[model samples]
Target chain A: MSQKMTRRRLLLGGAATAAVAMVKSSFGKMVQTGIPEAAMDPTRQVGPLPGVLGTRSPFEHPQRKASLTSSQTPLQDLYGIITPSDLHFERHHAGVPAIDPNTYELTIHGMVDRPTVFSLADLKRFPAVSRICFIECSGNFRKPDKETITPQDICGLTSQSEWTGVMLSTIFREVGVDPKATWFLAEGSDAAVMTRSIPVSKGWDDAMIVYAQNGEAIRPQQGYPARLLLPGWEGNTSIKWLRRIELSDGPFMTREETSKYTEPIKDGKIRQFSFTMDARSIITYPAYPVQLQKGWVEIRGIAWSGRGKITGVEISTNAGKSWQAARLQEPVMDKAHTCFRYLWQWDGDTTEIMSRAIDETGYIQPSLKELITARGIGTGYHLNPVTAWLIKRGGEVVYRPEKWK
Target chain B: MPYWACVAGIAMISCERRVNTAPTHFGYGRPATKQEIAAKAIAIRPDGKGLPAGSGTVQHGAVIYAGKCASCHGVTGTEGPFNVLVAPDTADAVPFDRAPQRIKAIGNYWPYATTVFDYVRRAMPFNAPGSLSDNEVYSLTAYLLYANKLIDSSTVMNAKTLPGVIMPARKYYVTDNRNGGDGPYE
Candidate 1:
């Protein structure tokens, strides 16, 4: 790798010097005339050396936009499946806490036979497991009003990572979880001490206590020492900076579960503990900022479902009047984001394009109108609607804003 | 000692194969003490479980609110610079679809009274969270409830009295029924 980089650097240096010399000679006679010996490529040229760390090119400046409470991932700038650890979206109640892994401890008490506290090292000693999955904030939707919105602006709160940890079922078996314990409380160590009540069935199924993201230690914004990973569930329920897990016979009814994260549904009823995210998809390319061309354009996007693997993604070229299947990228895993693409030839005409996802459970993504009609206008959280992009005759792309109260 | 003998000894000590229905304890972590568990187990349930022994009056809470919470939640808890903790008088009568114009205050939205206490004690005072005493938390909870008209000024809130304060919106909270499908939403 070092040798290849050295050769490439040498070639780049030669090309750069030649280009500069060409520019210097093009208008040298008209302007300041004499090309000095030192002015024409007489400079220091050093060979590239191997480094312990790597960095993105200086030209690539993708960054996560942040507010006071939350930071959004640059979803439109990502490719393939895994989101870079630094670019992961963060939504915390208080702020990220700096914790020392050597002193980190997680307590599991309540309805267990033997209440134990596991240190960071002790957790790593257990059977190790790795899985690629996406964690999306339950409130990950934006009601766009104009064409200036990109896919990242529409939904930048979901990110996928190769999480590494032991299965929660393994720890449950070791602690001898009482069968009568219906729910458990997972709490964080931040200033807010964020807590959420989770059903025990999820723990027995596929819940994990992850300590690493991608291929390295988890980022501080993503929980640093440790966090609870509930696959296919809302991001808030997967408590970050995890420190305690207390099993109980019922939901603890914490403030987060009661006051926040709950959604208002039909018939004047508020819905609580709505965990699994529904099937959703968004077209990343040709989405707001990117203009469309008249000729062949490959429409690309990502689709994911909390229920299971994304089975299919259908694209509609002329709004929702007609639909066709988009090709799904290979190796679609369960509870993970799957990339999809479609080949299209856009004529010089104004049209609307959109994509809808169908998960393994045969559930199709709903439109914003359908969702509002069912849940009512005052609804705020857990909104997953089909996003549409409007392409004008002049190759301008814009978001099709839906009327949301 | 020969190197092969050391390798054989290491292998014999490392690999111990056993098949059992129950997972054997890896004996990794230490046993958590009763006191340690009590310190971190701060969650309060809807049934009044885990409430510390403390009491506070709405009058005491008013003072604390003006000093600590008013800057973020407004003077009367309705006119918020941040989040509105109290809604207008007619907020409850409004239908669910149109209530988005009004804030989801304790009177109009929160289902449980215990949640107020838990939220105030766990995360309040926006600037300095978890800095209030148990009595102070109870007082603030009482003040917010009183300001929202769920409770009276003379009411002294404690673990025993808090669970009995039936929030009007408690009956409106239902478990999620939206099983994903292609048909009409549940």
Candidate 2:
């Protein structure tokens, strides 16, 4: 029977008769269903109206890969340099707090001529500045040993945004910061009340008190009302949920800087306050979980440096034996993620492919072996090495794991 | 006006602003009061700048540790369902190493002893953070120090004594000098 006739029959019959008919129809031959008439006729249905806010399409799904303490951005899914504010990587000591912007106040004290408290309104009144930069966690490296991992699994803790706020220097000058003050502590308002002692030079340099990200109010996970933006530094140093700035003469030696973030180097010496994120790059295309075809393939990825702009990116389709320069997307801003692409035709051969980033300072991204030899086995933080992807003859792309030691 | 004169005038004004001792400030935020600063300032420096006036003995800390910290950190503060805070006596004196058997207890990894007090007062008890009093925080610091064998069990921890108590791992801390100049170190 037709679907329309069946619906009419169900409406006409009572519960007992309908149950008998359903059983009788199931025992008979099966029938195929076709498209509904409303779908083909546009005038029969009405579309949704304009909304106050926009949302991504239901078909498109870009999600952060989360763990117990942190979540990584979907680096492979992202297209451009600026990461969507909602999809930005998050690493919080405690969980995110629900802070009310109307009642928010950021205090600046310690070793200053005049300690000051700035409201959100007052912070907005200052000369606002916007710059595109990446905030990379010092512990962003993940050694992938499986074929199921994607680019997001390898290293997705770094994210770029067009951050907008008042320059910390402007606020420092307003608060009459003393020249004798060498360092200032940035404290968060989260449950952990995270704190880090940042150098005074950074405050006077490119540091900012960011309230807006990616043309919108900062997300709660990304520190909603306000956060400190220390360009080219470790993400932890740029404290989210920034509530206080206390200038001091020396380092705070907090738990984060001491027991947590610090790592042992060669000769059993611990390296502390290693703020700057080293240059690194990962090939997003031809990554794991995505099968490749034997044809013209455009290898694409992102390369960034905390030191300066990414000058060049070298791609080696045949492993690390030889490398050729990949074309960088135009307008590669300083300390921002720069898109890179290389055109290659695969002969369906099983080989390893990787990319190395070269920064303006002439520093080449090192291999895992070289990094381990320099820092030794105990080192865990700031593990930025060239990651490789293995391409199987059957078109399966897998992560080429290296000796973490 | 002549181009040269205009350029000279602009340069003089810039120079005057730079040299001015009392420059026009941005004057955006209100001056924070002493009370306001004290209420929000919780960070303790290595030099004991923010250490409150209080003292605690290891005897008191042991009781507090058993009740509050032992559930997460082990009973002796070393055996951990969480992070290991104590190390065995047979372990290497300098525990920072590439060897497979490296123990990063408070006695071996932490560079500053005062950090224990600051961390406990700020984010301890895990469930009720920032709930510990200055005396309790100091006691916990002393207790952990004693447990790690960094200090005597009878030693009282205070602002004056905590900063002077040097950590064994303090000598191994070196400032990061990676300038992106060359290989792996960069």
Candidate 3:
């Protein structure tokens, strides 16, 4: 694999701390120091001893760009399905809260025969189930009509991880949920006390109260002690820092649901409770900020859907006139991000390239124009359009800007 | 039969415990008390199921809005550096789906009146959330509603009347229509 690697070495922790104290950047800033340029090649040198935790190479700074309410993951730098827990995109109504795992307790009440409180340890004692899935924010699409934008800047709110926990069905059984319950309110413990009314069917179907993410305790930013994980649904429904679950007969129209998540449809109506993310794909390579060479280039990207597994991904080399199927990387799990690639020999000619995901439900990823024709450009949520990149004959690549019509 | 054995592995769950038909409660947690549930039960439904018993008038709310909320929501509740709380022109008459600007606010977009109370009580004032009293939340809800012309100056916002104060935009809300198929994208 040809790595777009930055210049090297970052010394870290313990003995490196003292060594880092000696180094400064060109501007006289106290930058963490690595071995001198002479020692850059690792083949001849002995590495330092292992520490409590490992750190990424100092040169590799794959990070999330943070905003007031959300952060975008650096999609171009990632490999495979599982997103590094730290690099996972975050969307929170309130900032991450510090909660002690020992004191963490989840209260399940309302419309249940036996309202109960389970400590974190008590929860782990129940049957554990782990599954890999992608959690994409319904509002992951952002096309600002800029050609200089990277794939990370376009749609980086989606991320994947193998979450481990006890199923909500097991918890419901433990609490003896009432038969009349059709909906349940999931409440977070953050300052906003963020709440969402979820269908009871979702709980019985595939919901979980997850504590471990990608194998370890979930990071505080991703909800420390525990969170509610609803596979294939929008990220907002998976209430982080989950504190309470109240079963009810109808939906509780909270501010997030009514004022925020709802989208404007074709008519004068507002579409509420639109939870699933549509099938979408974007070619990371040969995309903006990544200049390309003429010969053999493999187009690579990720495709996922809330409905089911990604069945196929069609690649268009000449701006959507015709298409060919890309190779789907194996171990394609349900409702998870699946990688796709296609080999192409560029002839040093200026052209546009794009990819569209087709899910098991046979839902083909639509273009920005089609999305606007169907849902209108009024609502800024649930947009998953076929993204294209304009490859210049001079080996420069840029995003083909699509205006929100 | 070993219940733990059946629950240990997802692949090894063929044990009769999986077919208990009626699941045996694992008894992992203790019964929650009413106080425990009520302490964190702050969410208010559209039907006012969880609305607190306090009351506030538009006049009283204006005072609270000026002191605590005006810094972030603007003194008039319309010009916001963050989110505009009031927009009277874009009320029930405006078809948001086709509107030119599509500037949504509490009056034109929000469907539930109780949400004002619920949201303010949980997250408001910007500097310090969940710091508002029940009376203060009611006052702010009334003040914002009054500013949006959704309620009269004399109208009191409380448990009994909050739910009955039907929002104009409530009629336009519908459940999701997209069923993910070969059909057209809705």
Kindly list the per-residue Cα lDDT of model 3 for residues B1-186, writing each as its tens digit.
487765676555556566755445888889899997888788898889998788998998999889988888787977777798997575566576677466788888899898888888888866899898899888889989989888899999889989888688888899998888889888
| Docking class for candidate 2 | medium
lDDT of residue A180 for candidate 3: 98
Chain A TM-score vs. truth, each candidate:
0.90, 0.89, 0.92
Error of 1 at A277 (Å): 0.3
Error of 2 at A55 (Å): 1.4
| Interface RMSD after interface superposition, each candidate | 1.4, 1.6, 1.2
Question: Candidate 3 — which residues are off by over 4 angstroms?
Answer: A1-34, A38-45, B1-23
Better by TM-score, candidate 3 or 2: 3
Which pairs, if any, clash in model 1?
Answer: none
Ranking by lDDT: 3, 1, 2
Please give, for residues A1-405, the per-residue lDDT of candidate 2 as tens digits: 444333322111221221111121365743322323234342332322333454453236688989878999999999978899878999997789999999999999988888989999999998899999999999898764566778887788999999999999988888888999999999999988999989999999899999999898999999989999999899999999999999988889999999988888888788899999889999999798779999999999999999999999999999999999999998798898999999999999999999999999888998988888777777667888998999999999989877655
Give DockQ: model 3: 0.67
Query: In CAPRI terms, where does candidate 1 land?
Result: medium
**lDDT of candidate model 1 versus the reference:** 0.85
Residue B7, candidate 3: C-alpha displacement in angstroms: 27
Task: Enumerate residue pairs that collide in model 3.
Answer: none
